[model samples]
Target: MAIPAQAPPAEEVVADPVPPPDRRRSILARIWGVYAIRRIVYALSVVWLVTTGTFFMIRAMPGDPVEVLAGKLSMSGLTMDVARVRAEQALAWDPNANIFVQYFEYLGNLLRGDFGMVIGLHNTSVLDHIMKYLPWTLFSVGLGVVVAILLGMGVGMIMAYYRNGLFDHIMSAVASTLSAIPNYLGAMALILIGSTWLGLFDFWDMRGRISIGVEPGFTGEFIGDALYHAILPLITYAFTITGGWMLVMKASTTEVLGEDYVTVARARGLKGRRIGMSYVGRNSILPLIPQVALAIGTLVGGAVIVEKILFYPGIGELLIGSITTRDYPVIQGVVLILTCAVIFTNLLVDLLNSWIDPRIRKEGAST
Candidate 1:
């Protein structure tokens, strides 16, 4: 009876249940949790919308490419019907085709990397036209932005350090006034003050992107000549934009200076230069990163006016000419390129910001 009691004492063990895999949720999280992937999708969607809008809007303009080319041909002694036929053949476009059909065709061509031929210009590629002129705009506007950011940030930090002092007061007023002035007006003022009244440099000499004689190369002479022509547009862009950067930087810097960490750094007996550079300056610059990306788009738009006034042969200049001639292919191509540039820059900046700031990455991942 004791042996039987001992044998009955063995207890059974129970295993814990395993959870099922959430395959659907895991897939969604993998796709959506990635910040760069989301941003790229958004950018691509924007490009598609812009491309669609640009295609329709250009067609909606008063004259069609056929009509415009025909008009020019009619001026050269061809009958209207004959001119239209020639135009249609040359442009390889059909005005009578279904609008939706044309749109789909355009999308197909775009997918295949075909921007189409320039209307009225026999066999000229739209991509070639863009490649030819885009660099000038990038050089002038891009250089101007860099210079303005550097100069503005330096002066702004100084203003923040010397807050309410005479230097600060003077700069604040000047920055406010300059920021209020339109860039085009500032450009005209430069022409009037520097070229017309001051006679510091001849506008005629600096009218184009570069002097005709200078060959395109990495040589110093070529570089100097290019800079000489870009100087006015550069000055206009830098001068007009610098004020805004200064104001923004001054505000950001001032805010950073008041933070507890800055006060603690001062308490720790850190040198003024070290505190300014390492603590205040670095923290203050974060907000400006997004703004700088946006400013690239704004500057490109402004280049239309500035380049037009200055006679610089950039994409802006090309765009203006395309519009004047009702060159739908060229106009569409240019607008598409501009839109892509803006979207690409913003997307790049978003990725860069996420990389630089762990907080952004964390927030994005949770969402």
Candidate 2:
């Protein structure tokens, strides 16, 4: 009887059917879900748009390069026809070509690493000009940004810690005033107060990136002289930007101080210093990381005005001269460089943000 019962129970024990894998979705996810790849594509698209716009806009300006050169040559007693011929011959680009044609050519040349030659400057390569001037601007502005960020973050943390006290009130007011001032205005004020009113430093002596006789090297004399000339612009940049940083960090820190983790850390008997730094300060600074890259771009653009004011020989100064002379190649080259700088920096910051915050990477992947 037991054997008969066991024999009756051995019916079909079929397994559940397994669905086929979604190969298409899996492939699409691999291609589009990568955060760095998306950011890079976006950056490249922006660079292309900027390059195109800059190319056309420069050509659309009221005066042409040939006319500008011709006018200058006429001032030197050459006949108008000869001056025009010389201008045409000296230019790396054709003034009479269709703009669309020139644009395509420019793009082709750009792809080949050819930036064309600077007009009215003995046909110097645009890349060479940039190499010569970009470093000074980077040195001055980069140092200033670093100093401003450090000073501002520290002061901001203090302001948040002492919220609404006398020191906070004083600093808030100072920050507001400084932030309201334009960077060029800051440069001017520094010149006025330091040179005109107080006679603290001679404007003439500080007009360039360095003293005339200092050779370029790692030597102390060259370094010291470069710093001396850079001091005014650096100070102007630091103070002008520091105020904004302080205000931002203060707001960020204040918000973080009210966060649950910060509160929990405090309640867990963590020391004030440890809690303030490890929990509050660290979280507060996270939002500012993206801003640092943006600040670099902003500073580079602002350098045009500040460098012009200071007579500092940075790319900004070169850009101004190019614009004034209608040097199309140099103008296009400088603007393209600046645009690339800003776009790529933002891309890098995005990737860095993804690395710093897992949530960002997760969100990016899901998309």
Off by over 4 Å in 1: 1-26, 258-270, 278-291, 361-367
Model 2 earns a TM-score of 0.84
Tens digit of lDDT per residue, candidate 1, span 1-367? 4654455666777764743468667887788888888889889999999999989988888887888889999999999999989888887567689999999999999999999888777778999978899999989999999999999999998999899999999999999988898888988999999988989999998999878878999999999999999998899899998998998999999999999999999999999999988999899998788778778777886788888898889998999999988887888888888888788888878888788787887897786
**Each candidate's lDDT (Cα)?**
0.88, 0.89
- Candidate 1 — worst ten consecutive residues by lDDT sum? 1-10
Worst 10 residues of 2 by lDDT: 1-10
In order of appearance, the predictions have TM-scores of 0.85, 0.84
Please give the clash total of every predicted structure, in order: 0, 0
Model 2, position 110, has a per-residue lDDT of 95
Query: Any residue pairs clashing in model 1, and if so which?
Result: none
Best by TM-score: 1
Q: What is the alpha-carbon RMSD of candidate 2 to the true structure? A: 6.9
List pairs with backbone clashes in candidate 2: none
